[model samples]
Structures are given as C-alpha cells and as structure tokens.
Target: MENCPFCKIIERRLPADIIYENDRILVFKDINPAAPVHFLIVPKQHIPTLSDCHEGHTAILGEMMAVVPRIADMQKIGVVGSTPETRTGGYRVIINAGPDGRQEVYHLHVHMIGGPRPWKDNK
Candidate 1:
C-alpha cells in the first residue's frame, strides 16, 4: 500500500481538502465531484473494500454510518431542515469496490453526494 494515494492521504503524506478527522476516520472533499456536494469518508486503517472487512471492523463501520447524517447536516446537504430547492433535494451514499465497481482508489471509502442530480447525459 506504499503507492496507494489514499493511504498517503491518511498518512498525511498527501494533500486533501479534509473536512473532518478523528482517531479512527477521515473525511474530505472529493477532487472530482459527481455532484455539487461530494465528499469521501474513509477509515484510518487501510481496508481494500467491504468484502475485506472482518467482525472487528463492525464498530468502526457503525460509527461511520452513524456520523453520515451529522456530516451531511454540517455540509447543508441533509434532507431535514434544509431549504427547499437549495441543493438538498436528497443525497446518495455510495461505496464502489474494486475495478468492476469503478473504484479508483484501492482504499475502502464511502462517497456522499448531494445537490442537484446531474443530467443523465453527463456521465
């Protein structure tokens, strides 16, 4: 994992638009955003994908899931208390694993996207 970009980021060897960090996780804005608001939530420990996870990882995964709503609210992308027509039509959370799923980074991560859904033809 020496050459892994995300591992470098987690190690503070690379730069990222980091929004949140804790002993167990890191959150940052995605450089190439698919939506107006897009960010990545990653674990401090390197795990290739959900498929690689073990029972010991459950608590950390749960913590990450529980934090998503709070993070979304902080970004003004949460459904509750957000102004109508103000880029919070709803959000999508995605985790793409491996090449078949179009995962560019080998590190396990979750993508949180919101704002106006892009035009179907855009992709």
Candidate 2:
C-alpha cells in the first residue's frame, strides 16, 4: 500500500479530481474515461478485489453500493425507468477482479459510467 497511487491520493500526496468524499469512501473522475461520464467509487479500505472480501466486509460493501444513486444524481444522470414510456437517465457500475478481469489497479473500486452513448472525442 506504500506505493499505491490511490493511497497517495487519499493521503493528499497526489492530485485527483475528486468529486465526492465521505468517511468511508472517495469518489473521483476517471483519468481515462470510457464514457460520457465516468468516475470511480473507492473504499477507504485498501481491498485488493471483491474476491478478497469476507464477512467483516459486509457493511463496507453495503455502504459502497448505497451511494450509487446519489452519485448518479450528483452527476445529473437520470433514473433508469423500467418501462419504455417511463425510461430515462442511465448509469453502469463495474467491478473488475484479478488479472482476468482486466483490473489495472490492485485496489478494489467500483466504476460508475453513464450518459449518452458514442461519447464524442472531446480532445
């Protein structure tokens, strides 16, 4: 954990475009976004992956999931309506594990992405 970039960010040793921060987690924009809107919700605890979670992690995991809608709303992302007529707004949450899962960072985190598809190249 000494060399973890996220840890440095948490420790204020690195700069991050942080959007949200609570006692238990930190939310920030992804450096290389894959969608119109993308951010990472990371637990303050340095968990390596979902598979590494145990019974003691239940509350933290639950807390992590509980804030998804709040984050979406903060980003002005709309709701996910169940019916075609009511359909609106959208977002996605992803958790990659281990090497096979294409996780670039060892710390466990959730990726929340949404907004219009075919994101135009902003650069």
Candidate 3:
C-alpha cells in the first residue's frame, strides 16, 4: 500500500486537488482528466479493486454510492440547475475495475466526468 498513489494522497504523503474528504472517503480532481470536469472518488481504506471487496465492505460501499450524487452536485456536474446549457444536467459516473478496464491506479475509485462537450467517443 505504500506505493499506492491514492493511499499517499490520503496520508498526506502526496498532494491532490481535493474536493471533499471525510473519515471514510476522499474525493479529488484527476491529474489526467478525461473530461472538463473529472474527479476521482476513493475510499480512505486501501482496497485494491472492486474484486477485493468483501461483505465487510458493504456498508462503506453503500455510503460511497449514496454520496456520489451529492458530490456530483457539489462539483456542478449534476442536478444543480435546470438550464439545458448547464453542464450539471448530464454527467457520467464510471468505475474501472482493473487493468483491462483502463484502471491505472490499483486502488478502487470512481471517476465522475462532465462539463463541456460530450465524451469524445459518444460523439
């Protein structure tokens, strides 16, 4: 876990553009963003990936899922206003599970993406 980049960020061993943090989770802007607004939401604990999750992780996972929408709103990526031109109207929430899924970081995290333009491939 010492080499885990997200763990380092959670431990303050590394710096990140943190948007939210609590005893259980940490949310920060992705260094290499795929969208105009792209951030990573990670658990404070070191879980390698979704595959590593156990029954004991259910509550935490629930909490993380419950918070995603709230955090997305706070990030102006969803449900903040009604204007069709607003970036908050539509966004994509993605969780890449492993190497085959394009997950660069071994730690489990969800990517929240939105803002200007639809995802390139969607076009």
Which consecutive 10 residues in model 1 have the weakest lDDT in total?
A: 81-90
Query: Which 10-residue window of candidate 3 scores lowest in summed lDDT?
Result: 81-90
lDDT of 1 by residue, 30-110 (tens): 998888888999998889888899999998888778778888888987886455655334677888988899888888899
Q: Taking the tens digit of each residue's C-alpha lDDT, what string does model 2 give over 26-114?
A: 99999999888999988988998999999999998998889999999889885967899998988888999999998999888999888
Instruction: Between candidates 2 and 3, name the one with more favorable TM-score.
Output: 2
The C-alpha local distance difference test score for the whole of candidate 3 amounts to 0.86
TM-score of 1: 0.87
Model 1 residue 1 CA deviation (Å) reads: 2.5
Scored by CA lDDT, what does every candidate get?
0.85, 0.88, 0.86
RMSD of 3: 2.8
Number of the top candidate by TM-score?
2
**29 Cα displacement, candidate 3 (Å):** 0.2
Per-model root-mean-square deviation over C-alphas? 3.1, 3.0, 2.8
